[model samples]
Target: MDKQEQALGLLQAAVESMGGQVRPGQQEMVKHVVEALDEERHLLVQAGTGTGKSMGYLIPALAYAQTSPKPVIVSTATLALQSQIVGRDVPRLLESLKGKLSRPMDVSLLKGRSNYLCQYKLGGGYPDEDEGALFSMDEKPPASGTVYSPLANEVMKLREWAEHTETGDRDELVPGVSDKAWRQVSVSAMECLGSQKCPMADECFSEMARARASEADVVITNHALLAVSAFEGLNVLPDFDVAIIDEAHELQDRVTSSVAGALSARMVLTAAGGAKRHCAVNVDELTKAAHRLEKSLTGIPTGLMDKGLPEEMGIALNDIVEQSRLVLALTKPEANAPADGGRQTARSQLQAIMDDAIRMLETEERREVLYTTRPREFVDGRGYVESDPGTPATLNVAPLSVAGKLREGLFDGRTVVLTSATLAIGAQFDSVAGSLGLMGAGAPSWEGVDVGSPFDYPKQGILYVAKHLPKPGRQLSAETLDEIEELITASGGGALVLFTSKRSAEEAAEILRPRLDAEILCQGEGSMKSLVEQFAADRDSCLFGTMTLWQGVDVPGDSCRLVIIDKIPFPRPDDPISKARTEDIARHGGNGFMQVSATHAAIRLAQGAGRLIRSVNDKGVVAVLDSRMATARYGTFLKGSLPPMWPTVDKKTILGVLKRLKP
Candidate 1:
């Protein structure tokens, strides 16, 4: 049989094995994926919900891996989807295809180094300067601040577990400890002393994971690690010739984060502390630079630093660069000097600070974007203008455009197939393709295929736009809250209210709880999993949340009959990255708002509205309280990105329909 036929046959078997019917979209997706892999071409597939997209690609990936000497890599955006693929889908597919292939396929879930335990760190061979106090087995805090210190109680528990665990994976541990505690036992990829230098080189958990992935037929990882490996040139995963990106839309953001660098007062202090003993010059100079950096950062308003930093901040940054440089030059170890893990680590830390501190003022190369961020707000969501600026502002630098880098580093050299339910925004893949470096002038040749969803959207759901409500602003609107209350009452409390901001969600829940009959559960009041489970279990309960609730949440059946959006989920106006990118686009004679801001809002709006329907039997109403969705000229573009739900604007009609939809 041809590859297409073979893939389809495998998919059919997988569907039957999972007790599911074969979907036409899934069949089409499998054929396209197989062709893409065989031809070594770039392909973008928009496979809507219920398309069985995972099986569609996996069946072909299995076939390709068997034929090629290289393993296939699959990257996902969320932990939930990764878990679904690793914990459920891949196993079922393998079970169906058992004995049908030349040899059994091995699927290994490979995570970044930090996810696995570092034996060197656990063995007390090296401790980060910030964590030198760790590895003590003392049960109690140091009495009267004496020098006699012992290992933390939590660290002792981890050591006990380390002695018997096989995989040495943090996820395998139950009743997980805090990040502060975990950092003591584990090391990041950069922090660890390599096998050649480390005494515990044998049987390293991270190394063991890489060895498994290297031998496996398929390797699965998240976008974060994929970005680091692909763009940052980090060896976070096993080498592969082909990649299947499940959530293709999140690629740009993930890559940006992986390559981005930040400099802060905390980083300065930490670097200085680490380099003290190793510094040939007086470490006091570096400490003085840290304080100078903090003073310069004080009272600097936080936003995009497109034009430049304040004169004082610039001078302070220059001082940091020089001081770090001088220290590095003076602290070089002799060529044949004994391998001291501590000294080696200190130099690496200092070098990173110097590089980023220089990048903060990088203006000649327009390829990077620079911004400043204010310290996090107090728990009350308020901040005061203190003279000291308690916490210094952080300066960040990120690639302004990752397209060229991705094109050269990823898409150009490999066969890549990107699939997602929302890949085609407004029925076109041009936007997402551009972001992934598969489109535009001189970009790699690529094709896009749209495999429509199985569910009949027009019949399964309604898109209700409240055009008369007041526009969202600095303050929450009473009319919007009134509309929400009426909808919850009419729908009999099966509502998922999505707000643009956490503060707004809290305010809405606070105002609605006493007036509504249903048990109102706010997002932060409980864990998201527990809140979502409770909401799904009780038909008369309402769960209100922000961005976290927009995607990766599935609530099928009558329990989620109403989805209320407080507003169009746009990038925050003051967002530094957004401002910088928009300005850059505008400078290049482009419509910045349309390309950057509106597209962002449309993608998120689609994701939020998607929460209303999860299965073929699901029937619900997506109520968008923002009038702009119906009245603005860009409204058509935004609406086109969503599922083709039955559209309406009459409030009375929607309310009557909700009343009828009551469980």
Candidate 2:
């Protein structure tokens, strides 16, 4: 047999050996992805939910890796997935493909610094530093006057254990450390001391990971790190011939968030405080900058206000930026100073914050959209001043083009294979491709394929929309609440009710809590894993959340029998970044709402629906509370993006399906 035929035969035998049945479409996808690599073209594969996409891409990539000179990088959206590939998937496949491929392939997990244990903390490097407190204690101690003193001991313990541990991955640490504890051991992108300067450079976990990545045939990493490598222009990933981006649907948002930077008064003050240790400049400038920022921010109200991001506020933000740079420049220490390490860290941070401020100030984007949030309103009675309790002022920005940056700064002629379950929006690959700059001039010619899902959506689930309800208004409608209560009661609390906003989520939870019999789990009540664990432990538990929960959550089987979407997720008005992006789209004569808003919601909704039936036998109901699914002209498009479920508008039919699935 020829190369193609032999490879196909191996895949067929491999799947059967693992007790899986291979379909023709799946085999074709594998072949095409492999073929794309051979030609040095980019590939956008939209493998549906159950297409066994991991193996499909892995097989081809591994085959190419053995004979090809360069290694392959397999990027994923989550650490959970990275682990699955490096720890589970690739190893199993290696054994399966052994002696068949040209040679054995090495696979490794490459994570950013924060994912590893800090040896300095373990050895008690700097107990006086801000985060040093985490290493000072074994337990949550009383808040000390200094930031880093009290937690020193705990940091040492964590460091020592990390050195002895086999995986060195935070995930493998038993009982898993808390975020606070993890913060002490792990370093953020900004806070990370470079390999050359770090005290523990020789035994560094990050370096060890890099070494493995360099030698491996396949390297796996999370979206954040992948974006960081691209953004920072770091050669952290292996010399990959091609990258298969699993969970490609999240690429835009993930890349946008990674590139975006945030600044707060507290962060500035902290950095300024750190700078004081090195420079002879007066500390007064740092304090002044913080006070001025507070004064300017005082003009707006915290929390979800109806007002859009006003041009005046943008200008005020610019003023704050000016003061910020003045302080940073003044406090910046001499290059040869010993404390220059801390000063450099602070300067980079201030610069990142300045970049965001400048982006908002420089853009001529109008704020037509507004997202009303319940951020703590900090005001001195001028009707919504920025200082509100619980309300935080945050800005969102998405890069207009990352393709040039990725190609020139990140990929630089490397082979890349982007994969995701929901990469396609209504059967159009260009929609997602355009967002990532894959449509850039002289971009590689990549193949595209959709490996179908294993689940029969049309047979296993029903898509129910409350067509009778009034169109959802700006606020959570009464009819929407009523439908939620009804669905929860009918489904016996084995449900996940996702809202467009946190306020609406809490409101719905409050309304349904008294009436529903099962335990109610709200997102803010605890960490995501805690809430998910609680929901999974109790069959009748219901989870109510917004945004992240729409896609990040996963619960298979009857524990989650129904998925309820409060409304379509559209961009909030007054959001600085989204507003600017929308205008940018319109200026180019494109439908901003359809391109940015609708497409975002459609992908999220698809992800939410995909959460319901994780396996072939899993059955459930997907209920969209918004009547817009049937009334709006764009409704059909959104509905079509979801799984080909047996859709219905009948409330009774949905309840019947739930009853049959109930224990």
**What's the TM-score of every candidate structure?**
0.94, 0.84
lDDT of 2 by residue, 551-574 (tens): 777788789889999888777665
lDDT at residue 333 of model 2 (Cα atoms):
50
Question: Under the 3 Å rule for N, CA and C atoms, how many clashes does model 2 have?
Answer: 36
lDDT of each: 0.83, 0.72
* Ten contiguous residues with the weakest lDDT in model 1: 381-390
Q: After aligning candidate 1 to the native by TM-score, how far in Å is the CA of 411 from where it should be? A: 0.6
Residue 163 error for model 1, in Å? 2.4
Candidate 2: regions farther than 4 A off: 1-3, 127-157, 280-291, 300-398, 401-404, 407-412, 440-444, 524-527, 530-541
